[model samples]
Target: MNNKTAIVTGASAGIGKATAIYLHKQGYKVFAGARRIDHMQDLVQQGIEAHALDVTSPESNQAFVDFVLANSNSIDVIVNSAGFSMQGALEDVAPKDAKSQFDVNVFGLMNITQLVLPTMRAQHSGKIVNISSIGGQMYSPLAGWHYASKHALEAVSDTLRMEVKRFGIDVIIIEPSGTKTEWAGIAMKTLLEQTPKDSAYRDIVEAYADGSFDGFSDTPEQIGELIYKAINAPKPKTRYQPSFSAKMMVIAARKLSYKAFDRRLFKQFRAMISK
Candidate 1:
């Protein structure tokens, strides 16, 4: 087993947890950070170090990095997987809620990324993987805040990639289409909570939570495997679309004209709410 160490954020459950366990199984020393330390008992039993980390807090993020450096001496890979979806109409979403979404999905991600950059750049050989989503590229009915955060993430990852390439650190973006995780359910709950019943967007929000849309949803384990693959690659690609049909969607979204895409999206949402 190799001694190379990797840190995974959002490690208590879902994609982060899955990726940490998989990397550990494959011979890397793994350190996982999440808010819920109680949920990481299994990782601890398997020799993976798990720590409590509130990604929004700089102190918490710094401490997690310090702990990893103290134990492993070097960090070879970092998978930024801590995130959530905050779905709402642009006009309907509260300002505080909108700020909170960016706090977790965009700014919080950068908080941890900043902590690891000095280590990676100093090593002159490391990998940084950012978990983006299909929302980064495409737009939908009522998920304005969630999509905007991901879009910002995409820009941030792209900029980081260009800035860090000189240091031999590879920056990669993983965009998953529909993955079976708490993300969707949490987004649905947010929609129900924020959008008022009398709001014009209410019908569409209800349709979203009802799962009226159909698409491929990969398992968390599946996405985990992809992240592991990215870490192991000697020369990883700039971006990877891993979910079933995700690449197709990304390509289609890019190719379609603005009006064309809007027509299709409007039709889909209208159909969903009509039922």
Candidate 2:
């Protein structure tokens, strides 16, 4: 991977930040992209090229792509890690909020991938790693919109992998369980914002939010290492369910029917509320 150029969105913090640092350590010329460029100043100090990218904005995405193409001539890897959760019941989430979630998680990811594909195809070798969530495969009632976005991403990534194989470009999905990042804190805040004190789902939402905040979430570095492995591997897999529980949950969801899965999910939610 040495001397290769990589563009990692959401590189200001959390998994994106860790991944950028990890890639840099592995000798890749990393282009760390985030909305808050100042937040990535540390990455610049560490020799990673930092770019301002608001994935939700088409102009920003295009500008970043143009910048990369002008400077590096080719992008070896593109990691779409720019996304967030807007947690709440489906009925409670505002339409605008739901659309915004899809704008970032789905449209933004797709835009960046489309921009990078031409270069990857020309090179005949490149990797695209999309950071999705375990919630994509196994839904949590508390994070309805977030789960829906990830599910969409899961499908898109799967489809892209098959379509891009002929071009020698690989599309890999990274499904992480609850990782120790600001993601849960932000999700909890969104949950409280959408759920009023008297709402029917308030207690359940609070319980799930609290549990997520207190859970043994995996470290961002763990995900970073997994991403690094995917980038370096001779033949990367289609999907990497990283965390222990994440992999197990996907397995369980696959084995169980819909009714069984719903029952188990409800039981788990009820137990959390009871605690």
Predicted structure with the largest lDDT when compared to the true one: 2
Stretches > 4 Å off in candidate 2? none
Candidate 2, 129-190: lDDT as tens digits: 99998888877686788889999999999899889899999998999887888777877887
Q: Evaluate all candidate structures by whole-model CA lDDT and list the values in order.
A: 0.87, 0.88
TM-score winner: 2
What would the per-residue lDDT of candidate 1 be over residues 1-275, giving only the tens digit for each residue?
79898999999988899999999999999999999999999999999999999888989999999999989878899999998766778888888888887898889899988988898889898898989988899988787888899999999999999999999998889998887876677767768987988988787788878974356468889988998888778889988998548898788789999899899888877878788
Query: Which pairs of residues have clashing backbones in candidate 2?
Result: none
TM per candidate: 0.96, 0.97
RMSD of each: 1.3, 1.2
What shift in Å separates residue 167 of candidate 1 from its native position after superposition?
A: 0.9
